[model samples]
Target: MTSLVVVGSGIAGLTTALRAASLGAEVTVVAKAALEDTATAWAQGGIAAVTFPDDSVEDHVRDTLAASAGLGDAAAAGIVAAGGAEVIAELISHGVVFDTDSSGRFVRGLEAAHSYPRVIHAGGDATGLEIQRALSAAARAHDGIVVREHEMAADVVLDGGRARGIRLLRGGVLHADAVVLATGGAGALFAHTTNPSVATGDGLAMALRAGAAVADLEFVQFHPTVLHAPGAFLVSEAVRGEGALLVDETGHRFVLDVHPDGELAPRDVVARAIADAMAEGRQVFLDATSLRGGTAENAAFLASRFPTIDRAVRAAGIDWSAQRVPVTPAAHYLMGGVVTDLDGRTSIPGLFAAGETARTGLHGANRLASNSLLEGAVFGSRVGAAATSAPRSRGRVGPDAAGPGPLPRQAPPRADLPFSRRALQRLLWDHAGLRRDAIGLTRAAATVASWRASRPAQVADAAAAEDDNLLLVAEHLLAAAHARRGSVGAHVRSDDPFTSGKTAPLPEATLIGAPC
Candidate 1:
C-alpha cells in the first residue's frame, strides 16, 4: 500500500490528509505544534466564495486578477474560482456549519476589491475556528489517518530528484511515497505581525534545500489595519467592509484622496497609505462609529455579526459602535512560496506543497481577501488525489542519491547566535516591511549574510536550526525585493514611483533556489 506524509495541521494539511486517506492511502500528519496552533484557526476574516445567484465564477476570477494587478495566472485563478462552491459543499458534508441569515441563507459579507457580497463566515469572526473544529474532529475519527503533534519537519529527504520523505528535528525519518508541505507562511519573521509564533518559514527553507523552485518571494502582504495595541490583534477587513472608515489623526479621511474606493481599496493601496501616514508620525484609526445608527438594533447587529472582534475591542476599552480604533500596517501574509502547479506538484516529483507554503500563482503580486482558506480546501483535495493516483513513486537507489547533490550542506559547529529572535524580527520589519528601499535592503542582506557566515558549521539544537531557516528565508525575501527594482502591488518600493492601475509591465515571477 502507498503511504503519504503531510507536515502541517492547518486547513490545507488536514484537508489533504483526510482526502488522501479516504482515497485508500494511509496518511501520517506531523505538526510542529498543537493542531489548533495553526494560522488557519486564527484567521478572522471568513473564506471568499461565490455561493449566490448574483455571484459568478467569472466575478470571483476578475476580482482576484484585479487584486493581483496583472501578475496573476489566469488559469490557476480560474481553477480556484471554479472549485469554490464544490469545496463549500465538501466542507458542509464534513459537518462544517457556516453562519446564515434568519431566512436560512448563508450569510455573505463584503470585503475589499470584491465586486459582490460573496464572502461566507461562521460564528461571525470565528469562521476559521469553526472550520478547524469540524475538520480536526473528522480527521481524528478517520481510521486511515495518524496524526503526530509536537513534531517538527526539519527537512525533505530527496533521492535522485524525487522526494523520499521528511526528516524530523529530533532525529527520526518517515520514508513515504510522497510528501506534502502545508507548513504555512513566514509572517513571524516580521516584528509586528498577526501570525502566531510557529510561522518561521520552516517548509520553505526545507524545500529550497531539497531543490524546489520558489517564486515571487518578495510579494509579502501587510494587513492594513492591525490594531495598534499590546497584542496587535487583527481587526478584520470585514469591519471595514461594514462601513468603517480609515482616518488619520484629527479625523482626516486620507485614503479617499489616494484612491476612489477609499477605505474599500485593495489591501496594498490601503497598507501603503497607512504606512506613509505612520511614517509621518500620524496615527491611523479605523472608525466604525457611523455603523451604530444610534439605536439598540444596530448595536445588537454589530455584536452578533462580529462577536470575536467586538469582544476583543471591548476588552481593549474601545467600542466600535461609538469610537475609532487605532491601527497600523503589519506583516500578514506571503503571496509566494514553493512553486507548484494547479494540483500542488512542486518542481521535484513526489514532493508537493499546499496552503501558504505553495505558490500556485492564484495569488500573483497580491492575494484577494479571504481566498486563502478557499485555496487550502480546493487545492489540498486536488493534491491529495493526485498524490495517490495511477503511478506510485518509488525511491531511486543510484549514484545520484548517494552524491551530495542538492541536499543542504552540513552546518558549521553550533555557535552563539549574534542576534535574538526579537532583534532579527526588528531588522526584517524595518528593512523588508511594507515599504522597501535599495539601501535598507542591501544593508539588511549583508548583515544577515554575515551572521550566516559566522554561524557554527553544524546545527547545535532545534532552536539554532530554526534561526538558520529564518535567516535563509529572510535572505530570499531581501534578494527578491532587491531584484525587483520597480514597485508593484504588495511589493511597494519607496525608491520607485510605480503605482497600481498605471503600473509598469508586470515582471515575471521571481523564481529562486533551484538546483544548478
Candidate 2:
C-alpha cells in the first residue's frame, strides 16, 4: 500500500485524509494534540460562497480580489471563489450541518469586504465546531486512515528533491509516498493571539528547513477586536456584522474616521485604529447598545446572530442588550507561508501544503473574513488526491529502528546561548508588533541572522525544535518585512508609510525565497 501521511488534523488535514482514503489510498493523520484542537474548530464566521441565486461567481470573485489589495493572484482567487459552493455542498454530503431556514435553503451571513450576503453559517456562530464534528466523525471510521493523535511531525525527511517521510515524536521514521503540512500559522509567536498554543508555524518552519520557499511572511493580520479581559477572549466580527458599533471611552462612535465601511473596514485598518485609541488613554468598545443605525430592538439583534459573543459578554460582566463590550487588537491570521500552486503542491516536489501555512495566493495581502475555512477545505482535498498518486518506493530511506519516538517539541532556541519559547514570542511582540522603524527592524533581523548563522553546528541534535528552526522562520519573516519598504495590507511599517504613493509605482511585491 502507498501510505500517504497527512500531518495536520484540522479541517484541511481531515478533509484531505477523507478524500484520499475514498480514492483507495492509505492515509495516516499525525497531530500535535487532539484532532479537534486546531485553529479551524475555533473559527466563528461562516464560509463565504455564492450560495444564493442572486449572487454570481463574478461578484464573489471581484469582492475577494478587491479585499486582497493589489497583491492577489487573479487566477487563484477566481478558482477558489467560484469553487466555494461546490465545496460547501461536499461538506453537506459529509453530514456537516449548515444553518437553514424553514424553506431549507442555507441561511447566510454577511461580513465586511463582500458585496453580497453569501456566507453559509451553522447553529448561529458555532460553524467551525459543527463542521469539525462532521469531519472528525468521518475520519474515525475511515478504514484506510490511521490517526496518530499527539504524534507531532518534527521534520520532513527529505533525501534529494522529493519528500519520502517525516520524523515524528510518537512514531520515529514513518515512510510515506508524499506529505502534506497544514499545521496552521505562527500566531503564537506573539504575546496575544486567538490561535491555539499549538499554532507556532510548525508547518512553515518545517518546510523552510527542507529548502522550500515561503511568501508574504511579513503580512500578519490582527483581528480588530478581541476581548481585552483575562486570556484575551475573542469578540467575533460577527458581533459587528450583527450591528455593533466601535465606540470610545466616552461611548462615542469612532470608526468613521478610518473608513466609510465604519466597523466593517478590513481587519488591519481596524486593528491599528483600536490600538491607537488604546494608546491614547481612551478605552475601546464594541457598543451593541443601539445597533448599527436602528432602534432599541436592533440592540438585541446581535444576541440572535452570535450567541457565543453574547455568552462571552455575559461571562465578562456585561450584557450586549444594554452595554458596550470591551475589546482590543489581537494577533489573528498570517497571510503568508510555504508557497504552493493551485493544486496545493509546494516548491518541494512530493510535498504539499494547505490552510493558513500555505501561500496559495488566494489571500494576497489580506484575507477576506471567513474565506479561510472554505479555502482549506477546497484545496486540502485536491492536495490529498494528487498526493495519493505519488510513487511510494521509500527509495534508499531506511526504516525506523525504534519504538514510539521522542515527544513532540515546542519551538526551540538557538545553538550556543538560548531563551525559552515564551521569551522568543515576547521578543517578537515587543519590537515587531504593530509599528516598525529602521532601528527596530534592524535589531530583529540582526538577532535572527545571528541565530541562523549558528545552525550548521547543531545538525546532530535530537531535539525537535533546534535553534536553527526558530532562526530560519523568524529571519524569513523579518527579511520579507524588511524588503517590503511600504505599508500595504497587514504589513504596517510606521516609518515608511508614504513609500507606495501614486507618483512612485509600488513595485513592492515579495515572493518565495530563503533568508541570506
Candidate 3:
C-alpha cells in the first residue's frame, strides 16, 4: 500500500510525484498506458512561458483573460503569469532543453493570444515529449516514488467525508493518506481530437463520482488547423506563427479579407471562418507558399515538429513542404475541470487536482496558446508541494473506516460501444461543431439520453460495471451540452448566437444514479 497515489502520468502527474518525493513523501504513480502515450506527449505547440525581454506579466495575464471570454477568474490568471519564468527555469534545472535559434537564444513561436512572441518549446514542436521524458525519468528514479505503469486508477476511494485512497485492478488496494488526481482531459469523447485515446474523461468522471466539484464543462477548445483527412492528424498552429495563411477554394487568401487579424486571430474566430467557408461550399487551405521566409525549409521544420502528422501526410501521397495540408477543427482542450484553488486543493480534503482535469478557472472560456502545458507545470508543482506537506492521518484506516471500496469499475469495454461513441461524435460534429441550434442540440441530447437510459442496470450500481465506459461519458457530455444555452467560446449556440446570461455558468452534473 502506498502513502500517496497519483493518477495519470502526464506532466501534471509527473510533477506532482516529483514535488512530493522531493519533500520526503512516498509517491506512487498509476497510468493506463506507457508514460509516453499520455496527451502531454501529443502537444505540438510550445509551452507559453513569458520569458522574452519585452514581455510583461500584465500582458501575458491580459492575453489569458481575453481568451477566456470574460468568465475567466482574474486572480487565477494573475497567479499563472506571475510564476511563468520561475517554472521555466525550474524545468531547465530538471534538464528540459527547449529549442533555441542558431545564436542559442530561445526560439520563440507565436500562437493565438499575447502581444509578442512568448512561447518556449523543445526541439521545435516536441515540447510535450521532451518535458515528459525528463519528468518521467526523474520521477521513476526518485527513491520515494514508485511508478506502476499499465495500472489504471478505477476511482478515488472516499471514506466518511474525506479522500482516503485510490483502488486499482492490477493491485488490489493501495491505501493512501492523500491522493492527487492529475488525469488529463475529456478530448477523446470527440472523434476528431488532438489528444490520445487514453484521454477518455476518466479523471473528470472519477472526480465527479468522488464528489469533487467540477466547472467549465461547457467550454471546449477546438484547434482550427488539424489536417482534415482520413485520420485528421493535427498540423501545429506554430505553422501560422511561422507565416501561413488561410485561403479559400478559389485560391484567394480569405481570412485577411474577413477578419483584420486574418489567420492570426483567435482559434474561435479561425474555426468559425473555416466553417463558414465550408458552409458556402468552399474548402480552406493554409497558404504557406506565398508568405515571406516560406520554403521547403519551413516544411522541414513542420516535418520535424510533428513526425506523426508528417509521416501520415507522406503516406497520403502529399508533400507538405510544397503542398497545402487540408485543415479542419477538432476538439482539443477542456478549459474547465474539477474546481481547485491556486495550490490545487480540491473541495474534498486530502484530494488534489491539476492539469486539464482540474478547472481552476485559469483558462476561462478558452485557453491561450500554450498556457495549458504551463498551467500543468506551474500549478502542478505548487499542488504537489502542498500535498507533500499535508498532515498524515494519525491512525491507519480500519476496515469499517476505509473509503468507497475497491472503487467502482467503469462500464467495461465492448464492441458496440465504439459504434455508439462514433454515432454521438457524428451527431456532435453535425450540430455542435462551430455553430449549433436548439433543435439539433435537443435532438442530439434526446438520442444520447435514450441510449444512456437503456444501458445495462449493473452500471448504475458499481457492483459490476456493465456496458462500456465510453457510452457513459458520451451520455454525460450530451446531457451537459443540452443543459448549456449560450454562444460563449466553443459552446456556440445557433439559435441564440448572442450571449444569454451575463456570465453563463456551466451546469452542475446530474447523474441519473450516482453510487453515493
By lDDT rank, best first, the candidates go 1, 2, 3
Give each model a TM-score.
0.93, 0.89, 0.89
Q: Give the number of the best model, judged by TM-score.
A: 1
Relative to the unseen true structure, what is the C-alpha lDDT of residue 109 in candidate 3, on a scale of 0 to 100? 81
Higher-TM-score candidate among 1 and 2?
1
- Provide the lDDT at 106 for model 3: 90
lDDT of 2 by residue, 1-516 (tens): 667888888889998899899999899988888988888888888888877889998988788788777777888878888888889988998899988889998888778787888888886888888888889888988899998887767778775677877887544777788889989888877788888877877788888777787888777888888888877778878768767789998877777788889888888778888988888899998887776445456545666777777677788888767777789888898889999998889888888898888899888878888888988898888888888888876464655321122222223233343545666666677667776665676566565544444445424442335344555577667767766777777777888886351122122231223441
lDDT of each: 0.85, 0.77, 0.74
Runs of candidate 3 with Cα error greater than 4 angstroms are 291-312, 396-419, 457-472, 500-516
Q: 1-516 in candidate 3: lDDT tens per residue?
A: 236888889888888888888878889888877877788888878888788888999999999998777778899889889888988888887789988878988988888766778987896678888998888888777899988887777667776767777767444667787888887987766768888878778777667667777766667788888888877777778878878778877787777665688777878778888878878889888755544345667666657665666677778787777778678888888887788988999999989998998888888777888898888888888888888777676665655543342223333223233245577667667765667776775565555555555556443432223124444455545545555676776678777777652333223323322321
| Candidate 1 per-residue lDDT over residues 1-516, each given as its tens digit | 678999998999999998999999989999888877899998988999888998999999999999997899999899999999999999998889999879999988899999998999999999888889988888888999998998988888777677877888787678778899999999878999988888989989888888788878889999999888888899999999988899987999999989999998999999999989988999899988777567466568679888988888888998778778999888889999999988999998889999999999988998999999999999999999988762455553333332122334323333334666787899999999888887888777666766666667777777787787888888778777877767888988889857642322222222223421
Say which candidate scores most in lDDT: 1
Q: Tell me the number of clashing residue pairs for each predicted model.
A: 8, 2, 2
Candidate 1, residue 123: Cα displacement in angstroms equals: 0.6
- Decoy 1 TM-score against native: 0.93
lDDT of model 3 at position 160: 70
Write out the backbone clash pairs for model 1: 411-457, 411-458, 412-456, 412-457, 412-458, 413-456, 413-457, 413-458
